[model samples]
Target: MRNVSINQLDDTPRKVVALGTDYSHGHLLPFHTHRRAQLLYGATGVMQVRTSDGNWVVPPQRAVWIPPGVAHEVLMLGVSTRSLYIEPGAVDLGQRCQVISVSPLMRHLLMEAVAAPLMYDRVGRDGALFDLLLHELTRSEVLPLHIPMPAEGKLLSLCQTFLNKPNAHQSPQYWAEQIHISLRTFNRLFRQQTGLSFRQWRQQACVVLALARLAEGEAVTRIALDFGYESPAAFSTMFRRVLGQAPSVWLEAAK
Candidate 1:
């Protein structure tokens, strides 16, 4: 198996490895792609991957499927992550990348795959293992954590800046002016490109930040205040609206 630098990874066949490890680095890898599909899951820690498609956060309950040869990067707490890589042609797994929730059966299968003996020479076992992994993957749920990318170029840049900061709420008109476009044009273009209004986009970003904070076990009051809510109650209301549950409930489920 050839281990190339992350920059050298592309959508081509080389050495495909089912690599597993726990890492807590904030940004796991730079924007990159490889010829093999990657199944990134962390059963014990917080993990999130950002691709051009959107953000895929791997909670203990889920796994992220990265299609073969797609240029994507990951970011999260670098602690313990169980990442697996499979070649499109090598394994009977799909080339389409996505995020899937982890079932107890799937988690147990993953553990077995990683624990296989290095000298295990049973092709039957290997094939069975890969097939089981693929089966588990087929049952994965595409999480909403993957917010689609905005196509309005200038507006997209503006949105990205806000997303990166994630601490301040930018008005749509302000973003429009910053992008040298009128407020009306900005709204029109955003809806045309992303199927979401400016407000929806911002809310998604805010929710992503909130999820990160929640994963860290941050206090609800402080997290809400940091995100510019006047009070925790308001923030909780908004959270329930977007997430279909209160922050505490969601966190409890995650825990």
Candidate 2:
């Protein structure tokens, strides 16, 4: 159903419900939960999804799979979304949130699904399309766009602060000192809490944030300098390392 709230159709006796909506730049969907699992696809622009455990950045033409009842908030930038709310028993993509690569066939399926009848025929073409969609979702590539948040109070606070103004050059010792822990202990604790080493986590954070800025049309050179990179080339190196493509190439593909 185009532009309709899921609450109004949550009880529909169907395995999947497709909805499409468009959001202006900088739109925010506050923390909310859904009775059914959600495959939120961004046909245009980017999406930043935040849950209790972490944050995920969904670039244009990708999607984020949100498990049933997982409370989360979404910040949409110039996004037009096609959402599939599926019954929990209908498919099991994963237990955790995932940013997945959307293939061209799957993209067309989503577009068609969103335009199908709200109570589409279970024994007809609409049903066949949705069935293929579920299969495609199972085969979709999971992207490394998630930054797991720490649960420890002090460390979590420090991590949150860093996200506000991320810098590639921020030393691990700085974070350690801010939390009044020895550098060694901090390293161990950081990995234990977030399942990522300090260096890896910092780079992931920078790339995710840089993506949001890039979507807003910020120059790569400025973003690189803001993140303390010596040059745009240096920043692009890190970006390519993490995402497997230079910023310009990725952005062009996204367009």
Best-matching candidate per lDDT: 2
Give lDDT tens digits, candidate 2, residues 1-255. Answer: 789989887998889989999999899999999989999999999899999899999989999999999999999999999999999989998788999999999999999999999889988999999999999999999988999999769999988988998888899999999989999999999999999999999999999889888977999999999999999999999999999999999888877
Clashing residue pairs found in predicted model 2: none
The reply for model 1, stretches above 4 Å from the true place, is 1-17, 24-27, 89-97, 118-126, 167-169
Candidate 2 yields a Cα-based lDDT of 0.93
Q: Tell me the TM-score of model 1.
A: 0.79
Per-residue accuracy of model 1 over 84-174 as CA lDDT, tens digit each: 6665655544544556667788777777766654333446685577567776676676655655567547766766777677653568878
* Error in Å for residue 153 of model 1: 3.7
Each prediction's Cα lDDT score? 0.67, 0.93
How far out, in Å, is residue 131 in model 2? 0.1
RMSD of each: 4.3, 1.0
